[model samples]
Target: MTGPTELPVPDTVDVRSGPEVSDQLLSLLPLLGEWHGEGVMTGTAAGSAQDVRFGQWMRFSHDGRGFLAYESRTWRLTDEGRIVGPDVRETGFWRPRGDDDVELLTASPEGLVEIYVGRARTTTSWELTSDVVARTPDAADVTRAVRLYGLVEGALMYAIDRAGADDPLRPTMSARLERLR
Candidate 1:
C-alpha cells in the first residue's frame, strides 16, 4: 500500500441527533453490527498444549464517528457444546487512516496491549502486522503478532498469529462469525 495521504474533509460535518454513519467509515460498514459464532482455540498455554472449543460474541458499532468501536467476549465450551465459563475479552477500535491504511488499537484482559497497522486489502478485508506490542509487568512475553480479517460468504472470518520471547510466530486463534444485526 502507498504511504498515508491527507484525508479530504467534508464540506460540512456536525453531530446528528440520531444515529448516523460517516462516509469515511463506509469501507468498514459491513462489520457495523453484532456477530456470534463458535470455533476452537489451539495453542500452548500454561506450559501445556491448550486446545478448547469456544463461542464468541463480537460487536462493531459507531456513534456518528469515523471509526468503528469493537468489543469481543468469548466463552469456553464443554465437549457437549455447552458454555462452561467465560474465557477471554477484548476491546478495541478499528480506525481507518485513509482510504486504504488503517490502525487497530486493542487491549486484552490478559494484560496485553497491541497496535497493528496495515491497509484494507479490500472493502471487506484487512491484513495487519503489529507495529507495537506492549505488555504489563505481569503479562505474557508476546513480542510479535499478525492478524487477518475478511468477510467470507457473508461471514466475518479472522485469524491471528503470535510469538513470544521463547517461541516463533505461530497460529493463536481463528474463527468465523455470523452477523446477528
Candidate 2:
C-alpha cells in the first residue's frame, strides 16, 4: 500500500530571513536550512579514552508558522574521517516569544528532554540557558547546559557547555556547519 501523496500543510524547507516567516522568528531565520560539519569532543565527555570527532547534520524548517522545527543527528567519526557509529540525535522546536525572547524545547531518544530560554544576542547570535532537564531512569546525568549559536563568516557555528550533578559547566562540543541549501 502507498501512503498519501503529500501532507496537508507540508513544511517549507527553504525560507530565508524574509516576511514569509513570523515576525517573532525573524532573529532565527538565518538558521533555516540544512547544516553539516564535524567537531571534536572531550575525552571525558565522549566516554572514551581520548578526544574523538563527530559529524553532524542539523536542519531548521517552518510551515509559515510562529515557530521553527528543528532536528539534528550526529555520527561518530574515525581518525581518518570514516563513520564509526551513531552518536546523538535530537528533535525540537524553536519558539520565539514576544519580539526577542526565545524558547527552545528539545528531546533526545536517549530519554532526555531539555527546555531552554534566552534571547537573540545579535542578528546572528543566540545564547540559551537550560531552564529544565528531565531524564528517564537510564538516561545520562545532566545537571545544566548552555548553548551559543552564531553565524560566523558565512557558517553556522555553535558551542555547548554542559555540567553534571558533580561536574562544573565547561565547553563540551562545537562545530562549524555550512548550509547545504
Candidate 3:
C-alpha cells in the first residue's frame, strides 16, 4: 500500500526509530519487541498421541512503516532434556487495517502459507481467524487455524488451534513469553 498522499514517503525507513508510524498500528505497540518462552504441544500425529516440549523465540518489529515485521523459531526438547531444532520457522507481516482490524500474511519453510484476519478486543489483545490456508503439494495437511494473543501480566501469551486434513480442530499450542526488549 502507498503512503497517504499528503505525507511524502521516504525511499527508506530505519526499522528501529527512524520514522513515525501510523496511529492505526499504535495499538499493537506492546508486541513490538523480542520474546522468549517455553510451552508444551499436545496432539496426534498419524493417529498416535504425541506430546512435545518446545522453546520459542519470537520478534515483532517495525521499519517505521504501517506494519510490523515478524519472525518466530521453535525448538523441540528431547526426552533427556536437551534443546534441539528450530523445527519450525515462520516469517510474516502484521498490518493494521484500522484500530480494531488487522491482517497477517505468513509463510513457513515447511510449505505453508496463511492469511489471518484479526480483530482487536483491547489495545493489547487480538483474536485471529484464518482467511486462507494454502500449502505446497508436499506440505502438511493443515486446513484451518485460529489464534489468540494478548498481554497478560506484562507478558505476551498466545494460543493456536489447528485442523488438518480429515482432522478435527483442536488445541495445538500455547505459550507465555517474557519480553526480552
Candidate that scores best on lDDT: 2
State the displacement of the C-alpha of residue 83, model 2, in Å, after optimal TM-score superposition.
1.0
> What is the per-residue lDDT of model 3 for residues 1-181, given as tens digits with 9 covering 90 to 100?
8667653534222335546666667777778878999876774521327777788899987657688889998888776769977666899998888668989889999899999998888988999999999999988789999999999999999988889879998888888899887
Error of 1 at 169 (Å): 0.9
Q: List, residue by residue over 71-165, the lDDT tens digit for candidate 1.
A: 99999887799989998799999898888888899999899999999988988999999999999999878999999999999999998888998
Regions of candidate 1 where Cα sits further than 4 Å from its true position: 1-18, 45-50
What is residue 2's positional error in candidate 3, in angstroms? 32
Worst 10 residues of 3 by lDDT: 6-15
Ten-residue region with minimum lDDT total, candidate 1: 9-18
TM-score leader: 2
lDDT of 1: 0.83
- A best-first ranking of the candidates according to their TM-score comes to 2, 1, 3
